[model samples]
Each structure stands twice: as structure tokens, then as C-alpha cells.
Target: MPRQDDAGSESEHGKIPKSTFEIYRAEGDSQFRNKSFLKAIECYTQALEIKPGDQYCLVNRSKCYLNEGNIAKALADAEESLKEDAAFHKGIFQKAEVLYFKGDFENALVFYHRGHKLRPEMEEFRLGIQKAEEAINNSVGDPSVIKLRSDGDLSFFYAAEEKKKPAARSSYQKPKKEDSGPKRAQRNKAPADSKTIKKMLGDLYADREYLEKLLREESAKARKTEHSEKIQDLCIEGLNYLDSRSEFWQQQKPLYSRKKSAMREAAEKDKSSAAKYVIATLEEIDNKQTAGEHEAAIKQATRLLRTVEKWSPEDLQNREEIRANLHSLIGNSQFELERYDQALASHQADQKIGEEHELEESQARSRDNIGRVLAKQGNFSEAIQVWEQRLESSKSLSPMESTWLHHEISRCYLELKEFNKAKELAEKALSYANQMGDNQWLLNTNVLVAQCEVRLKNYASAAGNFDSALEHARIVDNALAIDAINRAIQDVNQKLVEEEKRLEEERQAGEQGEGDAKPDEAAGGEEQQQQQQQQQEQQEPVQQQQQE
Candidate 1:
């Protein structure tokens, strides 16, 4: 075995001491533990090169790719591992995990079931099956009632092999010693037993029926656990992911429909084919924005604004919304460039269009943009006022949006040294985040609350809140957040020590001052008594002389 210290090292020959596959695998494992996923992938790749078709290295590399957000490569490696041995439990599980993350619950469930059959003792496979089932149900009601593949394959439970074996040759053609092995015998009997197949199908049908019934019940909606709702959201996310994965979905739907409608109307009026040019120009502007070419985006948006202004209301029914959006886009690009004054002017114009059109959604969005620009300009009081107005009228705001509003307002309060108000708003933001089940927002609100506590001199509470924020940050795998939280924890601890030391010094000074004052008071009383006796003696002598 390679020692931990030997990871990523080489001998005089520019190779590990043993130069064996295990050495490379061990180094990969070490790098994985350190969360250096890219480096781990490099090490695992080298290991696989040394030991081609090694199941362990392939699966490990797939996991590294998954962690690095390369789901396609991860799935490829996972399937490759399975090609080496279809019955490999780890490979099956890895493939299921990748599919699950990719939002392919049906395929994922099949692999999960396969892994469970191969390794009945593994709880992960069971959990995977349950999660995939829930996701499937959430997206489409009871699976049993849903149409299965036209072929005999029940893909949800057991995926058919992509390639089928050739039919058996005439009985006398293939008599050989190699064909007499147990593996060969198993392959010969690959089809499930009739009774077993029937039983599995019955179970799947029953599961589907139960899901259909549950979905039909009015009480079912009320009874859905928070986890189920989260699964439903995941289902929607998977759909969106699939849509984005396809080129037509990415390009044809959102932009083309509205642009084409307006362009058709405009072309009919002008008898010209300027629609394509306008569409291409708009796409170029968007591309520039996405590429972080803020200046170019702003210039393009300004030119587009002039063209849009020339279009009459007859050409575009939603002309105001379009013009407002262009202004908003320019504002956003300006904001990105830290041109707060120009951004503010653009967003104000967007708000004006919203007011003229009575578009509440656009108005709310414009107010938000304006507030953000104001905040960036250090006009936090103005920002807070704008955000508060926006919040008051936002009946349709999502929990995430509500959380943002509360959190940003609290941040403004914190900057103004209004600790109590800041803490109150932060707590409200936390509640909203909890309702949304958003760990990223949870992390943000928790940190905001901790900051409020720190400003209020609640160091202990701040420390506790910071610790909670750190846990949220870790769950989200935000390295920057984790590092910032760690530093915040350190700062809170330091403040706590300083506070204790300051209080102790003040207490000791108070005690010393009291002790000195007691002695001075007693000596002053003795001096007063002595002065009285001397005055009385002098008065008696004068009285006696007058009597004589």
C-alpha cells in the first residue's frame, strides 16, 4: 500500500516506487478526499491507463467528473464500467446516480432496481429506488397506469439490454469446452422465469395504481410532506434541464415566438424583410451581455431602443413592455459596469413604462432594479424605501423573492446601525428561506442574522448563528462561503474575548476606586472632629476672661 505522504510523488525514474496501478489509484483517492476533483480525475485517468477496463478506477473517475459538474462525461465513464461487467453493483449505482441527477428518473429507477437485485444489503440502492419513484410520481401520476414500452420491456423496472445476442445456432455447431462454463450457462438462461416476470409486473402495476389513486384524492395534496413538494420541484427542474439540453428548445420557443409575431406584423406594414435583421441584432445584444461585454451590450441595447421606438403600437401590441425590457437590459449592463447613475436613469424609465402600461410585474421588477442600483450607490435609505414599496405590493412574490427583499432590507438596516430592526428582518428572511427550502438563501439569511447579532453585541448568539451558516454553506459546497464563514467565526470569537477582557478591566478599576474612597472618607471625619475640639477650647477661654 502507498503511504498518504507518497501521494502525487515520483521516484528517480519519474515514476512511483512501484509504478503499479494501485499507486496511481491511491493517489487519486487521496486527491478525492482533499476535494481536488480535477486532480483526482487526472490520477484516476492515469490509473485506468495502467489497468485498462478496471472497474474501480472507472467508477472513481466517473464520481470525480460528477463532482466537477460534467454529467455527460460522468455518465459515459459509468456506462463504460458497466460494459466491462454488467452485474457490477457499483457501476450500476453510479449510472443510476448520474441519470437521477440528469433528471432521467425512469432509467435511473431501472438501474437502481438492478443494483438492489445484485446487492440486496446496500441501503443506497434502496434509497435511490425510493427517490426515483417519488420523482416519477411527482412528474407524472401513477406509473402503472402510464403506458409502458410497446415491446415486452418494462423499462422502469428492468432496462432491456441495448444490444441483443444473436439467436442460437443449430444445436451441433458450437460444442466446445469454453461454452460449458457456469457463466455461459447463466447467459443461456438470461430471460426471467415466467412466474417471476408476472410477479414483478403485478407489483409495478400495483405501484402505479396506488400513485394514481393518491393523486386523485383531494386530501393527498394536503398530506404531501415537504420532501414530496421538493421532489415535485426537482421534477420540474428535470424537465427544464431536458429542454435546455436540446438545441430547438434552447433557441426556438421563448425568443422566436414573440419576435416573429411582432416581425410579421411589422413586415406586413412596411413590405420589407427587416424582421430577420432585428431578430439577429437582438440575439447579438443578448450574446454580448452573456459574454460580459457590458459596453457593447449597452451600445447595442441603445441602438435597439431607437429602432423599437420607431415601431408604432399597431405593429407591436406589447410595445411598451418591449421598450421597457430594452431599457431594463441597458440598466442591468450599466449596473454590471458600476455605472450607477446611468443604471438608475434606465431603471426609472422602465418603471415609467410600467406605470403607463399598468404592468404590475414589470413595475415590481423595475423597482427592484432601481433599488439595487441605489444600494450600490450607497443611497441605502432610498433603496430601502423603494424595496419596501415593492414588497408591500408584491402579492405574487415567491418565497425566494420575499427572502431576498427581507434580506437586502436587513442588510441596509445593518449598514445604518439599526441592529434590532436588522435582526428582525433577518429572522423574517430566514423564515422565508425555510419555506422555500433553499439552502443557498438559508446560508445568506443565517449569515445576515449573525451579522446583526454581532452588531448588537450578542457575540454568543452570533457564534451559534455563524456555525449554522457554515453547515448550510458546506451542504451547498460553496467554497467561498465556507471560507468566509470560517473567518467570521474567528472574528466573532476574537470579539468575544475582547469583550470579556474589557468588562474585567472595568470591574477591577471600579473595585479599586471604591476601596480608596472608604479610607479617605474615614480620615476626613477624624479631621473634622479634631477641628471642633480646638474651636471649643478657644471659646471657653474667652468666656472665662469675660466673667473675671
Candidate 2:
């Protein structure tokens, strides 16, 4: 619910300067705190104009308007702020507050509960709900007489009312010893004095024995099922006492050690049950991811992994399997966030664990993930090598799996411009896909084969392969695949036409050159005869000149 500006800088004409906006917003806050509602509204309006859609300004203005008795404006501002961010608890609370003052207790209660659901720790929402419910109940008896009060007046009234309330006695006071029967005295002594309680929870934590004894006695007096509950209560009490004392006591190491030991014992006792808990937690994490709550999913998965790591090696039923799965889950979450290095590290850890445990399927999956991450990083060579090694090592691969690996390898080859290799692998993949009757794989392999043909300049063959791919895509009802195939077909057709046009132009240029060469040869022979006759005439002229 924290307010944040949308990405990108606003144009000069679209927004006031950031510094100016901040100044106005600050002035608005000052006026709001001073109860100058009208001035506050003006300042907030200026801020909003400077940076329109500012959630904080909207919420503040709503509060000002509500305080100034302008219910319509208050409601409008509150609703607008919520429309900008429905999950903003402040806006939800503001809307609820406005409704409460407007005497619309029913609607107020609804938004109050919504705000509470969003942020359970906010005391204002709890108080608001209490007040709203009270108003609703009171209105049932005297609907017309129910009056509304501003938040400021209400706050002052509550303060005055609190001062009028009586204070309770101190915890330090002790009861005086009284003359009573032996049985009554014994009952009074059972609840230990403060000194005894302090001594019992002090230094060596020596009172642990006394606490356990009490638990045992309590269990003996209760039903069998209640024994565990008694024990849990005793442990909680002891831990709480230790925590309280540690704040003032110098020696906290023992307290911390005790807490740690308690946690470890509980974890060891529930190791078997941990699997079901872990499975449920993992499913929740997956749900978060599917809901696009990536950040929350990452945090939950991380905490779960840490908790799992706390279990001793001997306590875990399937240690390596749990570790591998958790690491893979973390890697997937990280990958979604585009944190490639962290994802690679996580996948590698999973792969190492799988290899150490001799879990072939897990190891293969980890390797596949590693390859995928590598490919995403544009490390095609490494990705191809990893996948190829996996394919070679996997002797028991199903036809579909083999086809997938072939398709992956061919894709890498295509990226590397090794068209012939790509074509070869794609064809093999297509055959396996057809044999396995996997329409999706068949469509993908066909597209890959067509791509390779295009890279090799076999336009007609590429177009035909794409046509087959398009047909398969149609059968599968994959609109994206159909669209991609159609576009590929158009591209191939365009390339074919361009190629034919280029060839025809080259052929015409060759024919024209041949004709020009024949004419030049004939002209050359005529020019040589004329030059010889001219040379004879020049020799005669030279002789006549010499005689003269």
C-alpha cells in the first residue's frame, strides 16, 4: 500500500517540477496537521495538479474535505484514490472514515473490515470497525438522533474520556497473609509468590524441573489428550519468561541456548510430519507464483528452505530430495524475476545434490533447467553442450523426451547458423514426434525444420514445411502457432519472389553483355584495316617532304 510514482519522467508541460510538487505537498501536510482544512485542501489540490494521480495528495485532500463537512468531495477523493490503487489500505480506511462521519455505518463497516483484512496490525481500522458497529446498533433504536462527529473532535473527546477512567492496581502489590484453614492456605501457596517465581525462572533456568513437575501433575489431573496441551503451555510460559528476563538480565546466552534447544527438540519430534507441512507450504508458494505474487512467493520459499535446513541430517526423512526440490523451486522463482545468476547457482546446487544422491530424473531435470538458463543468457554453445550431454547420458528416455532434446539441440544449431546440422536433427525430431503422436512436438519440429530450410535458402521446401506445420498447428487449435506459421509462410514467399527476381536480372545482364561484345569485335576489325591504310599514306607523305 506504499505510494510510488509510475515509471518514467513526466514531460515538462505535463507536470510541475518535482521540487515544486514536494514543497506544495509539505505545505499541505503542515496545514492538515494544523486543522486548517480549507488551506490544506488548496495546497493538496496544487500538489495534485503538479503531479496528477498522486495517491498521498488524494488521500490527504479527502481527509481535509471530510473534516470541513464536504462529504461529497471527501467521498469523491477517497474513491478516486482507491481506484488508482485498490489495495492501498490508507485510501480504504479514509473512505470508511468518510462513510462513518456521513452516518452510512453499514458501508463504513464493510470498508473498515476490508482495510483490516489488508492490514490487520493497524489499530485505527480496528477502532473504526468498533465505532461503526456501535453506530449501526445505536441507529437501530434511534436512527434519526445518531449524530456524526469529526475525527479531531472525536479524538479530543476520547482523550478526555480516557482521563476520566480509573487506573488499575499495580502488579507489584502482594496479598497479605490471612488466618485460614490448612486446605485454603495450601491452595493459596500453590500459586507461587513473585519472589519464588523469579527465583524459579532465574540464573541456571533451574526452575525448568519445577515447571515440568507442574505440567506432569496437571496432566495427571486432566484427560489424556490435554497432557500435550499442558506441556505446550508450560513451554510457552517458560520461553516467554526467559525472553522477558533477557531484556534486563546480563546473561542472555543461556536463554538463547534454551530457546534453540526447545526449537530443535520440537523439530526433531515432528520430522515425519514435516513432509506434509512442507508439501502444503510448497503448494501455497506455487499458488502465490501463479497469482503473480512473485516477490511474496520468493520470500515464502526462502523462509521454508531455511526452516527445512534447520532439521538435523538424521531427522530428515528424504533430505536430498527435499533440498533438491527447494533449490529448484527457488531457482524457478528467481528465473521469473530475471535474476539469472542466482537462478543458475540454485539450479547448479540442485544438480549437485541430485548427482550426489544418484537421482537420475532429478539430475536430468536440473540439467535441463541449467541448459534453459544458459540459453536465456544467450550462451547457446554451453546450452547445446549441456542438453546434448543429457541426451547422451539418458539411455531410458521416453520418445517424447528424446524428441524434445532433439528439438532443443536443433534450435541451438539454428541459432548458431549451422543450418545443415539443424535440418538433420529437426528431421529426426519430427520423425520421433510423429511416432510418439505428440502433435505439439510435431508442430514445433516442423517449424524448426522449416526455419533451417529458410537459412539454407531452400525457400520452396521451407514454405512446404511451414504449410505442414500450419496444418498441425490448426489441428491442435493453437492460435499463436497458427499465426506464427502464417507469418513464416508469407516471409518465405516474399524471399522466393525476391530470389527469382534477382536471378532473372542476372540472366538479362549476361545476355546484354554477350551482344555488346560481338558488336565491339566487328568494329575492332574495321578500325584495324583503316589504320593500316593510313600508315601507308603517312609513309608516302614523309618521303615527298624529304625530297622537297
Candidate 3:
């Protein structure tokens, strides 16, 4: 089995990032070279999941399936590999090879011819054609006589009826001479001597003048000088070079060509084995968090974050986005654990990345998370600011999300004793809830609105809103909420009664005070009249004195 640790690194944070697809595919190739077909299939399957419809992965997987003797699966993969491009030469060769292995020599031959027509430079197709023909000849005797015209041209369509019968032989004895000269063809078969060797070397290496001269000198030295062993060694070296070249073109180059094309496209998307693995690991962290394994999730996310920080620009397409998400994951896990300070830092980091990159969605998420963390820590003022900023800055927020944000903001305002602001936001939240038609949100928002009203001393309105909330709670079948709303309604009704009594007492006090003020006014007028009469008398005396 392949090393699981290498498949997913836990702590190699400073290494150059390799693509997930490249890593897995390269591993698959290694396994294939080792004849580990099952392991190779696993690796290729992973590569395919990351990059669907990859020609190299599909064809290589087909080859693995073929090695496993899974003819059906092998053929299916081979056929699917060609679906994108029928002229994919590797796919053609693989399909033809599979058919030939499955004993369908006729179809194999057809595909081989097709491949040959498409890519004449490919030696595999030529070899396939020859094998398929041999298989056909072995399976069914060649009834039609074929005439070899020059070197390779053949008269393959000659009718069986055209085959001529041998003519009747007439016996005529002739005397044979003893030890007659060897036939010209017999001498041609002998190993070449010095002069003949020179001529053969000249003709053989004509295209390579350098090799011709080298071989000529070597051959001369081998025959006439003491460097015979050197010439022999050189001959062996040449044979080995030819074998290696033939093997490379026949076995390796075709696969390399297929991979080159796939890698070109994968590069454009910044996809690789390591990148895909990182994505998968991120999903795993999400699952762990969802499953309530907060500690484990935090640990995994921390390690992955370290690794991600070392990633090259070419390693992953959304490097910054992935980094922000990792921060979010860690923050969320910390929040779940009630580690408010650590959660705040992580969320702040996430927000910083979002703002720097201008990622709207990331910014929205970070703000929401940070707000929740702050709210949990009793920092309602800052939490409210964060949520309101999200509401103002984000246009892509869903109606449900908007309702939640408004509702949260109202709660924060209510916490700060800002009744009017709380009431306004609560009403806004209620409208959004109505639009979404969510009974739970409706119940929650109505209760919130009622609380704001109560804080504002609107007892009657609070009672009415509580009744509305109670109805919604009933619709949602929330038993706890039903009991709570009933108690709240009772409290509001009591407050209303108290409010009415207070209003009545104030009214009576005003009426009595008005009556008393009228009496005082009458007495004061009488006193003023008396004072005016005395003043008139005094004034008359003063006027008489003044006239004397």
C-alpha cells in the first residue's frame, strides 16, 4: 500500500507545494511500474476525482484494469477515455490492445489501422497491426495466396481461384560437377571480411557520416591492429544504445505524450495532486466540525494552515481563499469550545484576508463569526457594529441571512437598553421573516419585537406582539416557547393594568389641582380689589396735597 502519511502530510509546512493530481498520478505511475495494479487503480481513481475526464488518468487506469484481468472494466475505461477526443492516440492504442487481449483480433486490427492512419509516427500501432495479423492467420488459415511485390507491398486481394496448380514435371537426368563454385547468394551470407565490412559500414551509416568513419576505423583496427577488444566493446555499446532508444519510443514516449496534454490543461486551473488533497482535507475538517469533534478539527486545521502558508502560487488556484477558510474553520472550532480570545484572533485573521483580497463572501462570513464571538463575550456594542457593517456592505446576502442579521442586531441593541433602535431593527427583521415564511424565524422575531416594545413601555403593543409570537410558536409546536410566551403575555397584561391605574391617578390629581387653583384665583381677585380701592384713596390724598 502507498504511504498514507505522504498521501496527506501532517507537518511538512515548508516544502514546495505539489499539485494533488500530479502527486497521485505520479504515484499511480510508480505503482504501475511496480506491477501493483490495485494500488495504481486507487491512485488513478483519486486523480480522476480531482480532474474528471483527464485523458492520461483514464487511459492509465484502463491499463491497470487490463492488468487485473478485468476485461469489462478495462474496455469501459478505454472507451470512456476516447469520449473527449476520439483521435487520442493513446486511447486508440489502449482500446486496440484490450480488444486483442480479449481475443477480438478483427476489431483490434481495425483499430490498429485507424491508429496508424492517425499517428504514423507511433511504432505501437505498427506493432499492433503485425500482432493482430499473426493472430488472425493462426486462428484461421490464409486461404488466399498473397504475393510479395517489392519490399513491403503485398497483393493481399488475390483470389483463391487465381492460385495456379503446379505443371507436370518431365524427368531429364543431368550430370553434376563435383565441387562446383559456391552460389552468389551463399557468399553473400558469410560474415563480411575487411573490404566488405568497409562497404557495408559505409552504406549502413551513410546518414551518420561521423558514425561511419568511427565504425570504419574501429573495424580496420579490429582486423589489422591490436585494438580488437576496443572495437568489440564499441559494438556492444552501440547495440545497447539502440535497445534503449527502441524501448523509450515503444513503451514510454506514448504515455508521456498523453500526460503532457493533460498536465497542460490542469496547469491552467492550478490543479495538482497536492492541491486536490488539500481540498479533500479541508472537507474532512468540515465533517469533523459538523460531527462535533471541535478539538480534532482545530488541530487538523492548524496543521493544514501551516502547510498552506508554504504553498506556491502555482500549487492551488484559490490559495488565499483556502487560507481564509482554514482560519474560519479554526475560529469556528475555537468558538465551539468557548475559547473566545483565540476564536477572536482567528476570525480577525480571516477578516483581514477577506478585506485584503476583496472577497465579499469571506468578509461576510468573518464578520458574522466575529460578531457571534464578541456577543458571546458580552461585547454587544462591537458585535452590533460588526453585524451592521456586514448588512450595509454585503449585497449578496440571502433574505434568510438578512433576517438573521437584523434579528441579531436588534438583540444587541436591546442588550444595550436602546429600545427604539432595537424596536426598529426588530420590525425590519420581522418583515424579512414574513417574506421567507419561516415559522421559527417568525416566532423568534415576533418575540424579539415584543421584548423591544416592553422595553419601550408600550405595554398594550407588547401584549399584542406577544400574542402574535405565541400563535407562531404554536404553529411551530415549540412547547418551551409556548410556555414562555404565555408567561410573557401575562407579565405584559399586568404591566398594562398597572399602567392604566397610574394614568387614572394622574388624571384625578390634575382635576383636583385645577379646582383648588380656581378657588385661590377668586380669593386673590377680592384681595386685589380691596388693595385697588385703598390705592385710589391714597392717590386722591396725594393729588390734593400736590395741588395745594
For candidate 3, the 10 contiguous residues with the lowest summed lDDT are 183-192
Scanning candidate 2 in windows of ten residues, the lowest lDDT window is 152-161
Q: Please, what are the lDDT tens digits per residue for candidate 1 over residues 1-548?
A: 34466555766777543456887899899999887999999888877767777889889998888767566668778887877478989988998887776656667778888899889998677767765665543231222221112221111112223333233232213457777632210101111122222222333434434433443452357677756655544443333333222321111112112123342344345533344555566677765654345677889889988987998866554567668778888987787666789999999998999899887656877898888888778888999999999988877776757887898788777667687998999999999978866565676678778777776778899889889988877765545456656766777788788889999999999999999999999999999999999999999989999999
In angstroms, how far off is 526's CA in candidate 1?
Answer: 1.9
Q: Which stretches of candidate 2 lie over 4 Å from their true place?
A: 1-271, 508-548
Clashing pairs in 2: none
Report lDDT per candidate.
Answer: 0.67, 0.65, 0.67
Candidate 2: tens digits of C-alpha lDDT, residues 1-548: 11334324678677524446777898899998887989989888878877777889988999888766566567778877866568899888988877665545567778888889999998677766665654443211112111112210000001101112123222112454882422210111121223323433455455655665665675566555545664656454553434334221211111111122222333345547776687668778865653335567778988988998998767666666677777877787676667899999999998999899886655887888888789778898999999888988886876656776787778777667687998899898999878766555566677777777877788898889888887876765555456546766777788889889999999999999999999899999999999999999989988999999
Per-model TM-score on C-alpha atoms: 0.49, 0.46, 0.49
Residue 109, candidate 2: Cα error in Å is: 34
